[model samples]
Target: LHHLKTKRTEVYQDSSPFMSYSGCCCVLLPYSKCCYVLLPYSYRCYVLLTYSYLCYVLLSYSYRCYVLLSYSHFCYVLLSYSDCCY
Candidate 1:
């Protein structure tokens, strides 16, 4: 139904291999006899994939986050110190 929508849903099959489904799509499970569906406009579900796999997080991916934080702190310190000095 249109009221029910999910993202990156894991449809488990006892005998078959696992699959990751995502991206507002749908497929039929011939053996299990049910349709695996995903909705695109879903708010909870984001970044869906339709393959047997996993989600890997790159540690270095947050480098820019660290830089942004450091820059913000630097600016705050500079402004506060200037304010105090003046």
Candidate 2:
């Protein structure tokens, strides 16, 4: 885990260890779930969203202004059209 100045935060990456990503996952958060969401690394980068060792979704840049997202296995919508989470 990456330590901040004082507070301890969990270390998570957008890309999966077994899969691949290809879009800007301006990750907001899952609705009514206890999961972590990270900001997009770049405007055109890949991010693999996961939880509990389960690959939730594979992010990829579809278009210049397309908000591509995926629902979780439990029917959880982890992302939205506005992942511009700062």
Candidate 3:
């Protein structure tokens, strides 16, 4: 029992700093068959997910702007041609 307690304390001491740095809450779940370390929603995970989403949004907006600009330029050229022909 003493050895098991010491081992658990060591695990917490080793994992706490790393978990805190990443803004995660670490939980030790002991089941009848096994033990698992659960890390709930870390800031690093959120940042990575959000970064991809942000990149996607920026790319979509940039493509939209490029298309709108092309359309506007095409309309301008048509107007200029009509004026010249008239």
lDDT of 1 by residue, 1-86 (tens): 11223343564433333344444323333233232212224512112223223221111122111111122223211111110111
Clashing pairs in 2: 14-48, 21-46, 22-46, 22-60, 26-83
What would you estimate as the lDDT of candidate 2?
0.34
Give residue 74's error in model 1 in angstroms: 59
Tens digits of lDDT, candidate 2, 2-70? 111212123345435522223433332344222333335543333343455553442324311233233
Tell me the spans in candidate 3 whose CA falls farther than 4 Å from its real position: 1-23, 32-86
lDDT for each of the candidates?
Answer: 0.26, 0.34, 0.19
- TM of each candidate vs. truth: 0.21, 0.21, 0.14
Give the Cα error of residue 52 in candidate 1, in Å.
27
Misplaced by over 4 Å in model 1 are: 1-20, 35-86
